[model samples]
Target: MLPQPNRQMALAQYRLRARFYDAELAAFEPVRLRSVGCLQLQPGNTVLDVGCGTGLSLELLHKGVGPQGQIVGIEQSPEMFDLARRRVARHKWRNVTLLNAPVASATIACQADAALFHFTHDILRHPDEVRHVVGHLKPGAHVAAAGLHWGAPWDWPTNWLVWMAAMYSTTSLEGLAQPWSHLLQHLGAVQLVPSPIHGVFIVCGKVLSTGSEVVHHV
Candidate 1:
Protein backbone atom coordinates (compact mmCIF):
# COMPACT_ATOMS: atom_id res chain seq x y z
CA MET A 1 0.00 0.00 0.00
CA LEU A 2 1.20 3.50 -0.71
CA PRO A 3 1.82 5.74 2.28
CA GLN A 4 -1.28 7.71 3.14
CA PRO A 5 -0.98 11.33 2.07
CA ASN A 6 -0.09 13.97 4.63
CA ARG A 7 -2.98 16.41 4.72
CA GLN A 8 -0.74 19.42 5.14
CA MET A 9 1.48 18.38 2.27
CA ALA A 10 -1.50 17.92 -0.03
CA LEU A 11 -2.90 21.30 0.95
CA ALA A 12 0.44 23.02 0.33
CA GLN A 13 0.72 21.35 -3.05
CA TYR A 14 -2.64 22.67 -4.26
CA ARG A 15 -2.05 26.08 -2.69
CA LEU A 16 0.85 26.66 -5.06
CA ARG A 17 -0.84 25.16 -8.11
CA ALA A 18 -4.33 26.69 -7.74
CA ARG A 19 -3.60 29.61 -10.04
CA PHE A 20 -2.46 27.51 -12.98
CA TYR A 21 -4.77 24.57 -12.26
CA ASP A 22 -7.38 25.41 -14.86
CA ALA A 23 -4.82 25.92 -17.59
CA GLU A 24 -2.83 22.84 -16.61
CA LEU A 25 -5.96 20.70 -16.76
CA ALA A 26 -7.02 21.87 -20.23
CA ALA A 27 -5.55 18.80 -21.87
CA PHE A 28 -7.77 16.48 -19.81
CA GLU A 29 -11.05 18.20 -20.63
CA PRO A 30 -12.06 15.43 -22.98
CA VAL A 31 -11.68 12.89 -20.19
CA ARG A 32 -13.78 15.13 -17.98
CA LEU A 33 -16.50 15.20 -20.65
CA ARG A 34 -16.49 11.43 -20.88
CA SER A 35 -16.64 11.02 -17.09
CA VAL A 36 -19.56 13.42 -16.69
CA GLY A 37 -21.45 11.75 -19.50
CA CYS A 38 -21.55 8.57 -17.48
CA LEU A 39 -23.71 10.28 -14.85
CA GLN A 40 -26.66 10.70 -17.22
CA LEU A 41 -27.85 13.59 -15.11
CA GLN A 42 -31.39 14.90 -15.38
CA PRO A 43 -33.01 18.28 -14.80
CA GLY A 44 -33.30 19.46 -11.18
CA ASN A 45 -31.03 16.74 -9.91
CA THR A 46 -28.56 17.27 -7.05
CA VAL A 47 -24.97 16.22 -7.67
CA LEU A 48 -21.81 16.13 -5.61
CA ASP A 49 -18.49 17.07 -7.17
CA VAL A 50 -15.91 15.53 -4.84
CA GLY A 51 -12.50 17.12 -4.74
CA CYS A 52 -13.79 19.60 -7.25
CA GLY A 53 -10.45 21.31 -7.88
CA THR A 54 -10.66 24.81 -9.31
CA GLY A 55 -14.26 23.96 -10.18
CA LEU A 56 -13.15 22.51 -13.48
CA SER A 57 -16.17 20.16 -13.59
CA LEU A 58 -18.69 22.79 -12.50
CA GLU A 59 -19.90 24.10 -15.84
CA LEU A 60 -20.40 20.69 -17.40
CA LEU A 61 -22.16 19.50 -14.25
CA HIS A 62 -24.32 22.62 -14.22
CA LYS A 63 -25.24 21.99 -17.84
CA GLY A 64 -26.36 18.52 -16.91
CA VAL A 65 -28.19 19.41 -13.71
CA GLY A 66 -29.68 22.70 -14.99
CA PRO A 67 -30.61 25.80 -13.00
CA GLN A 68 -33.18 24.09 -10.82
CA GLY A 69 -30.67 21.40 -10.03
CA GLN A 70 -28.25 21.82 -7.14
CA ILE A 71 -24.49 21.27 -7.22
CA VAL A 72 -22.43 20.89 -4.03
CA GLY A 73 -18.68 21.02 -4.54
CA ILE A 74 -16.31 19.71 -1.84
CA GLU A 75 -12.79 21.09 -2.10
CA GLN A 76 -10.21 20.91 0.68
CA SER A 77 -7.67 23.42 -0.56
CA PRO A 78 -8.54 27.03 0.28
CA GLU A 79 -6.59 28.35 -2.68
CA MET A 80 -8.38 25.99 -5.06
CA PHE A 81 -11.76 26.71 -3.48
CA ASP A 82 -11.17 30.42 -3.96
CA LEU A 83 -10.92 29.97 -7.70
CA ALA A 84 -13.97 27.75 -7.71
CA ARG A 85 -15.88 30.31 -5.67
CA ARG A 86 -14.90 32.98 -8.19
CA ARG A 87 -16.06 30.80 -11.03
CA VAL A 88 -19.40 30.35 -9.31
CA ALA A 89 -19.66 34.07 -8.64
CA ARG A 90 -18.66 35.02 -12.19
CA HIS A 91 -21.25 32.66 -13.55
CA LYS A 92 -23.85 33.95 -11.08
CA TRP A 93 -24.73 30.38 -10.27
CA ARG A 94 -27.27 30.46 -7.44
CA ASN A 95 -27.82 26.74 -7.38
CA VAL A 96 -24.27 25.85 -6.42
CA THR A 97 -22.71 25.45 -2.93
CA LEU A 98 -19.01 25.22 -2.22
CA LEU A 99 -17.70 23.31 0.81
CA ASN A 100 -14.19 24.29 1.75
CA ALA A 101 -13.30 21.17 3.70
CA PRO A 102 -11.90 17.74 3.07
CA VAL A 103 -14.43 15.12 1.98
CA ALA A 104 -13.90 12.88 4.99
CA SER A 105 -15.00 15.64 7.35
CA ALA A 106 -17.31 17.68 5.17
CA THR A 107 -21.03 17.83 5.83
CA ILE A 108 -23.34 17.08 2.88
CA ALA A 109 -26.84 17.93 4.08
CA CYS A 110 -28.83 16.47 1.24
CA GLN A 111 -28.78 13.10 -0.41
CA ALA A 112 -27.48 13.58 -3.91
CA ASP A 113 -28.72 11.99 -7.12
CA ALA A 114 -25.23 11.68 -8.53
CA ALA A 115 -21.57 12.28 -7.66
CA LEU A 116 -18.52 13.07 -9.77
CA PHE A 117 -14.88 12.42 -8.82
CA HIS A 118 -12.88 13.58 -11.77
CA PHE A 119 -9.10 13.51 -11.27
CA THR A 120 -9.37 12.70 -7.56
CA HIS A 121 -6.70 10.07 -7.14
CA ASP A 122 -5.78 10.78 -3.51
CA ILE A 123 -9.42 10.93 -2.45
CA LEU A 124 -10.11 7.57 -4.08
CA ARG A 125 -7.36 5.91 -2.07
CA HIS A 126 -8.98 6.74 1.24
CA PRO A 127 -11.79 4.29 2.01
CA ASP A 128 -13.20 6.51 4.77
CA GLU A 129 -13.54 9.42 2.41
CA VAL A 130 -15.14 7.19 -0.21
CA ARG A 131 -17.65 5.83 2.28
CA HIS A 132 -18.45 9.24 3.72
CA VAL A 133 -19.22 10.64 0.27
CA VAL A 134 -21.08 7.57 -0.94
CA GLY A 135 -23.17 7.58 2.21
CA HIS A 136 -24.72 10.84 1.11
CA LEU A 137 -25.97 9.41 -2.16
CA LYS A 138 -29.42 7.98 -2.62
CA PRO A 139 -29.68 4.35 -3.45
CA GLY A 140 -29.00 3.81 -7.11
CA ALA A 141 -27.49 7.27 -7.51
CA HIS A 142 -25.00 7.45 -10.34
CA VAL A 143 -21.33 7.81 -9.41
CA ALA A 144 -18.51 8.38 -11.86
CA ALA A 145 -14.77 9.02 -11.42
CA ALA A 146 -11.80 9.51 -13.70
CA GLY A 147 -8.06 9.57 -12.89
CA LEU A 148 -4.57 8.24 -13.57
CA HIS A 149 -3.41 4.64 -13.26
CA TRP A 150 -0.50 2.44 -14.26
CA GLY A 151 -0.78 0.59 -17.51
CA ALA A 152 0.60 -2.87 -18.31
CA PRO A 153 4.29 -3.45 -17.73
CA TRP A 154 5.10 -3.39 -21.43
CA ASP A 155 3.31 -0.05 -21.75
CA TRP A 156 6.34 1.91 -20.61
CA PRO A 157 5.40 5.14 -22.31
CA THR A 158 1.97 5.14 -20.70
CA ASN A 159 3.44 4.29 -17.30
CA TRP A 160 5.84 7.19 -17.65
CA LEU A 161 3.01 9.56 -18.38
CA VAL A 162 1.07 8.17 -15.42
CA TRP A 163 4.10 8.59 -13.17
CA MET A 164 4.62 12.21 -14.15
CA ALA A 165 0.97 13.04 -13.69
CA ALA A 166 0.63 11.22 -10.37
CA MET A 167 3.82 12.72 -8.98
CA TYR A 168 2.56 16.20 -9.70
CA SER A 169 -1.09 15.73 -8.67
CA THR A 170 -1.29 13.07 -5.96
CA THR A 171 0.13 13.18 -2.45
CA SER A 172 1.26 9.57 -2.72
CA LEU A 173 1.39 7.07 -5.59
CA GLU A 174 -0.62 4.32 -3.91
CA GLY A 175 -3.39 2.65 -5.91
CA LEU A 176 -2.15 3.92 -9.30
CA ALA A 177 -2.69 0.42 -10.63
CA GLN A 178 -6.32 0.47 -9.48
CA PRO A 179 -7.28 3.89 -8.21
CA TRP A 180 -10.99 3.09 -8.31
CA SER A 181 -10.83 -0.10 -6.27
CA HIS A 182 -11.63 1.55 -2.92
CA LEU A 183 -14.67 3.17 -4.49
CA LEU A 184 -15.90 -0.17 -5.74
CA GLN A 185 -16.13 -1.40 -2.14
CA HIS A 186 -19.08 0.90 -1.63
CA LEU A 187 -20.37 0.96 -5.21
CA GLY A 188 -20.33 -2.79 -5.68
CA ALA A 189 -19.41 -3.51 -9.30
CA VAL A 190 -18.49 -0.52 -11.43
CA GLN A 191 -18.06 -0.44 -15.18
CA LEU A 192 -14.42 0.65 -15.54
CA VAL A 193 -13.09 1.83 -18.89
CA PRO A 194 -9.72 3.23 -19.86
CA SER A 195 -9.44 6.41 -21.84
CA PRO A 196 -7.35 6.49 -25.02
CA ILE A 197 -4.59 7.90 -22.86
CA HIS A 198 -2.47 5.05 -21.58
CA GLY A 199 -2.72 5.62 -17.83
CA VAL A 200 -6.21 7.03 -17.50
CA PHE A 201 -9.47 5.35 -16.45
CA ILE A 202 -13.15 6.12 -15.91
CA VAL A 203 -15.33 4.11 -13.55
CA CYS A 204 -19.10 4.46 -13.34
CA GLY A 205 -21.68 2.70 -11.22
CA LYS A 206 -24.80 3.12 -9.09
CA VAL A 207 -24.96 3.02 -5.31
CA LEU A 208 -26.19 -0.24 -3.95
CA SER A 209 -28.90 -0.49 -1.32
CA THR A 210 -28.14 1.10 2.05
CA GLY A 211 -27.77 -2.33 3.57
CA SER A 212 -24.63 -2.96 1.51
CA GLU A 213 -21.57 -3.21 3.68
CA VAL A 214 -19.11 -0.36 3.16
CA VAL A 215 -15.44 -1.05 3.68
CA HIS A 216 -13.87 1.49 6.00
CA HIS A 217 -10.23 2.52 6.04
CA VAL A 218 -8.35 4.53 8.65
Candidate 2:
Protein backbone atom coordinates (compact mmCIF):
# COMPACT_ATOMS: atom_id res chain seq x y z
CA MET A 1 0.00 0.00 0.00
CA LEU A 2 1.12 3.57 -0.65
CA PRO A 3 1.24 6.38 1.85
CA GLN A 4 -1.56 8.93 1.70
CA PRO A 5 -0.88 12.08 -0.30
CA ASN A 6 -0.94 15.61 1.11
CA ARG A 7 -4.20 17.14 -0.09
CA GLN A 8 -2.99 20.72 0.11
CA MET A 9 0.17 19.92 -1.82
CA ALA A 10 -1.85 18.09 -4.46
CA LEU A 11 -4.17 21.07 -4.90
CA ALA A 12 -1.18 23.36 -5.31
CA GLN A 13 0.39 21.08 -7.90
CA TYR A 14 -2.81 20.88 -9.93
CA ARG A 15 -3.28 24.62 -9.71
CA LEU A 16 0.00 25.03 -11.52
CA ARG A 17 -0.69 22.25 -14.03
CA ALA A 18 -4.35 22.98 -14.72
CA ARG A 19 -3.79 25.26 -17.67
CA PHE A 20 -1.57 22.84 -19.57
CA TYR A 21 -3.13 19.63 -18.32
CA ASP A 22 -5.25 18.88 -21.35
CA ALA A 23 -2.41 19.32 -23.78
CA GLU A 24 -0.03 17.28 -21.67
CA LEU A 25 -2.51 14.44 -21.45
CA ALA A 26 -3.15 14.28 -25.19
CA ALA A 27 -0.78 11.35 -25.60
CA PHE A 28 -3.02 9.22 -23.40
CA GLU A 29 -6.23 9.87 -25.35
CA PRO A 30 -6.43 6.31 -26.60
CA VAL A 31 -6.16 4.95 -23.11
CA ARG A 32 -8.91 7.28 -21.99
CA LEU A 33 -11.17 6.04 -24.79
CA ARG A 34 -10.64 2.40 -23.93
CA SER A 35 -11.04 2.95 -20.20
CA VAL A 36 -14.27 4.84 -20.63
CA GLY A 37 -15.47 2.27 -23.13
CA CYS A 38 -15.17 -0.36 -20.45
CA LEU A 39 -17.94 1.44 -18.60
CA GLN A 40 -20.45 0.24 -21.20
CA LEU A 41 -22.45 3.40 -20.80
CA GLN A 42 -26.07 3.48 -21.87
CA PRO A 43 -28.73 6.10 -22.50
CA GLY A 44 -30.06 7.77 -19.35
CA ASN A 45 -27.36 6.13 -17.28
CA THR A 46 -25.62 8.51 -14.91
CA VAL A 47 -21.82 8.29 -14.60
CA LEU A 48 -19.28 9.73 -12.19
CA ASP A 49 -16.05 11.14 -13.51
CA VAL A 50 -13.82 11.11 -10.46
CA GLY A 51 -10.99 13.64 -10.57
CA CYS A 52 -12.19 14.72 -13.95
CA GLY A 53 -9.53 17.32 -14.89
CA THR A 54 -10.41 20.09 -17.29
CA GLY A 55 -13.30 17.87 -18.41
CA LEU A 56 -11.26 16.37 -21.23
CA SER A 57 -13.24 13.15 -21.00
CA LEU A 58 -16.59 14.91 -20.86
CA GLU A 59 -17.19 14.88 -24.59
CA LEU A 60 -16.58 11.19 -24.93
CA LEU A 61 -18.66 10.45 -21.86
CA HIS A 62 -21.48 12.55 -23.27
CA LYS A 63 -21.42 10.44 -26.39
CA GLY A 64 -21.91 7.37 -24.28
CA VAL A 65 -24.63 8.61 -21.94
CA GLY A 66 -26.42 10.81 -24.45
CA PRO A 67 -28.50 13.90 -23.58
CA GLN A 68 -30.79 12.32 -21.02
CA GLY A 69 -27.90 10.98 -18.98
CA GLN A 70 -26.29 12.96 -16.21
CA ILE A 71 -22.53 13.43 -15.78
CA VAL A 72 -21.39 14.29 -12.25
CA GLY A 73 -17.76 15.35 -12.31
CA ILE A 74 -16.07 15.79 -8.91
CA GLU A 75 -12.83 17.73 -8.88
CA GLN A 76 -10.86 19.24 -5.98
CA SER A 77 -8.85 22.04 -7.55
CA PRO A 78 -10.59 25.30 -8.32
CA GLU A 79 -8.24 26.09 -11.18
CA MET A 80 -8.82 22.72 -12.79
CA PHE A 81 -12.54 22.93 -12.20
CA ASP A 82 -12.61 26.34 -13.75
CA LEU A 83 -11.33 25.02 -17.03
CA ALA A 84 -13.63 22.06 -16.80
CA ARG A 85 -16.57 24.33 -16.16
CA ARG A 86 -15.71 26.44 -19.15
CA ARG A 87 -15.35 23.40 -21.32
CA VAL A 88 -18.80 22.18 -20.31
CA ALA A 89 -20.25 25.57 -21.12
CA ARG A 90 -18.43 25.87 -24.42
CA HIS A 91 -19.85 22.58 -25.49
CA LYS A 92 -23.29 23.49 -24.17
CA TRP A 93 -23.54 20.20 -22.33
CA ARG A 94 -26.46 20.90 -20.03
CA ASN A 95 -26.43 17.45 -18.49
CA VAL A 96 -23.00 17.78 -16.90
CA THR A 97 -22.48 18.98 -13.32
CA LEU A 98 -19.07 19.95 -11.96
CA LEU A 99 -18.45 19.65 -8.23
CA ASN A 100 -15.42 21.50 -6.93
CA ALA A 101 -14.70 19.38 -3.88
CA PRO A 102 -12.69 16.37 -2.90
CA VAL A 103 -14.35 13.01 -3.43
CA ALA A 104 -13.90 12.20 0.27
CA SER A 105 -16.29 14.97 1.36
CA ALA A 106 -18.34 15.67 -1.71
CA THR A 107 -22.11 15.26 -1.29
CA ILE A 108 -22.94 13.14 -4.30
CA ALA A 109 -26.70 12.90 -4.25
CA CYS A 110 -27.50 10.40 -6.97
CA GLN A 111 -26.47 6.78 -7.39
CA ALA A 112 -24.67 6.38 -10.66
CA ASP A 113 -24.65 3.51 -13.13
CA ALA A 114 -20.95 3.82 -13.94
CA ALA A 115 -17.81 5.61 -12.70
CA LEU A 116 -14.50 6.56 -14.26
CA PHE A 117 -11.24 7.18 -12.39
CA HIS A 118 -9.02 8.16 -15.26
CA PHE A 119 -5.46 9.00 -14.25
CA THR A 120 -6.51 9.72 -10.68
CA HIS A 121 -3.65 8.18 -8.69
CA ASP A 122 -4.14 10.37 -5.62
CA ILE A 123 -7.84 9.60 -5.46
CA LEU A 124 -7.22 5.86 -5.90
CA ARG A 125 -4.75 5.75 -2.98
CA HIS A 126 -7.30 6.86 -0.39
CA PRO A 127 -9.59 4.07 0.81
CA ASP A 128 -12.10 6.45 2.37
CA GLU A 129 -12.46 8.39 -0.85
CA VAL A 130 -12.77 5.19 -2.86
CA ARG A 131 -15.34 3.82 -0.44
CA HIS A 132 -17.36 7.02 -0.38
CA VAL A 133 -17.54 7.21 -4.17
CA VAL A 134 -18.17 3.51 -4.53
CA GLY A 135 -20.93 3.72 -1.96
CA HIS A 136 -22.86 6.00 -4.29
CA LEU A 137 -22.57 3.58 -7.19
CA LYS A 138 -25.57 1.41 -8.03
CA PRO A 139 -25.11 -2.30 -7.49
CA GLY A 140 -23.20 -3.83 -10.39
CA ALA A 141 -22.28 -0.36 -11.65
CA HIS A 142 -19.22 -0.45 -13.88
CA VAL A 143 -16.03 1.13 -12.54
CA ALA A 144 -12.84 1.82 -14.45
CA ALA A 145 -9.45 3.22 -13.37
CA ALA A 146 -6.45 4.11 -15.49
CA GLY A 147 -3.10 5.47 -14.32
CA LEU A 148 0.66 5.03 -14.03
CA HIS A 149 2.45 2.19 -12.28
CA TRP A 150 5.94 0.73 -11.95
CA GLY A 151 6.92 -1.58 -14.79
CA ALA A 152 8.57 -5.01 -14.81
CA PRO A 153 12.21 -5.29 -13.71
CA TRP A 154 13.45 -5.45 -17.30
CA ASP A 155 11.26 -2.47 -18.16
CA TRP A 156 13.49 0.17 -16.58
CA PRO A 157 12.84 2.59 -19.43
CA THR A 158 9.12 2.39 -18.73
CA ASN A 159 9.69 2.81 -15.02
CA TRP A 160 11.68 5.96 -15.73
CA LEU A 161 8.78 7.39 -17.64
CA VAL A 162 6.40 6.40 -14.87
CA TRP A 163 8.70 8.06 -12.32
CA MET A 164 8.85 11.30 -14.26
CA ALA A 165 5.08 11.40 -14.73
CA ALA A 166 4.46 10.54 -11.10
CA MET A 167 6.85 13.25 -9.94
CA TYR A 168 4.91 15.82 -11.89
CA SER A 169 1.39 14.50 -11.20
CA THR A 170 1.17 12.61 -7.89
CA THR A 171 2.01 13.68 -4.34
CA SER A 172 3.42 10.34 -3.08
CA LEU A 173 5.86 7.79 -4.55
CA GLU A 174 4.06 4.90 -2.85
CA GLY A 175 1.79 2.60 -4.92
CA LEU A 176 3.80 3.32 -8.05
CA ALA A 177 3.86 -0.45 -8.29
CA GLN A 178 0.07 -0.98 -8.51
CA PRO A 179 -1.91 2.19 -8.07
CA TRP A 180 -5.22 0.42 -8.69
CA SER A 181 -4.75 -2.16 -5.92
CA HIS A 182 -6.50 -0.05 -3.31
CA LEU A 183 -9.47 0.48 -5.60
CA LEU A 184 -9.65 -3.24 -6.38
CA GLN A 185 -10.64 -3.95 -2.79
CA HIS A 186 -14.03 -2.42 -3.51
CA LEU A 187 -14.35 -3.29 -7.20
CA GLY A 188 -13.80 -7.03 -6.80
CA ALA A 189 -12.09 -8.83 -9.69
CA VAL A 190 -11.29 -6.40 -12.52
CA GLN A 191 -9.75 -6.82 -15.95
CA LEU A 192 -6.28 -5.28 -15.75
CA VAL A 193 -4.77 -4.32 -19.10
CA PRO A 194 -1.33 -2.79 -19.54
CA SER A 195 -1.02 -0.01 -22.07
CA PRO A 196 1.63 0.04 -24.76
CA ILE A 197 2.63 3.33 -23.23
CA HIS A 198 4.32 1.26 -20.52
CA GLY A 199 3.80 1.60 -16.78
CA VAL A 200 0.21 2.60 -17.54
CA PHE A 201 -2.75 0.29 -16.86
CA ILE A 202 -6.51 0.20 -17.33
CA VAL A 203 -8.63 -1.68 -14.79
CA CYS A 204 -12.36 -2.30 -15.17
CA GLY A 205 -14.84 -4.07 -12.90
CA LYS A 206 -18.32 -4.00 -11.47
CA VAL A 207 -19.43 -3.07 -7.95
CA LEU A 208 -20.44 -6.26 -6.17
CA SER A 209 -23.60 -6.64 -4.12
CA THR A 210 -23.34 -6.02 -0.39
CA GLY A 211 -21.39 -8.75 1.44
CA SER A 212 -20.24 -10.33 -1.78
CA GLU A 213 -16.84 -11.89 -1.26
CA VAL A 214 -14.12 -9.86 -2.93
CA VAL A 215 -11.53 -11.64 -5.03
CA HIS A 216 -8.19 -10.30 -3.84
CA HIS A 217 -5.49 -9.44 -6.41
CA VAL A 218 -2.23 -7.54 -6.36
How many clashes show up in model 2? 0
Off by over 4 Å in 2: 1-3, 211-218
Error of 2 at 189 (Å): 3.4
lDDT of 2 by residue, 5-75 (tens): 87999999999999889889999999999999999999999999999989999999999999999999999
Model 1 agreement with the true structure over 86-195: per-residue lDDT tens digits: 99999999999999999999999999999999999889988999999999999989999899988889999989888988889999898888888887776744787557
Model 1 ranges off by over 4 Å:
210-218
lDDT values for all models: 0.90, 0.90
Which numbered prediction scores highest in TM-score against the true structure? 2
Cα TM-score of candidate 1: 0.94
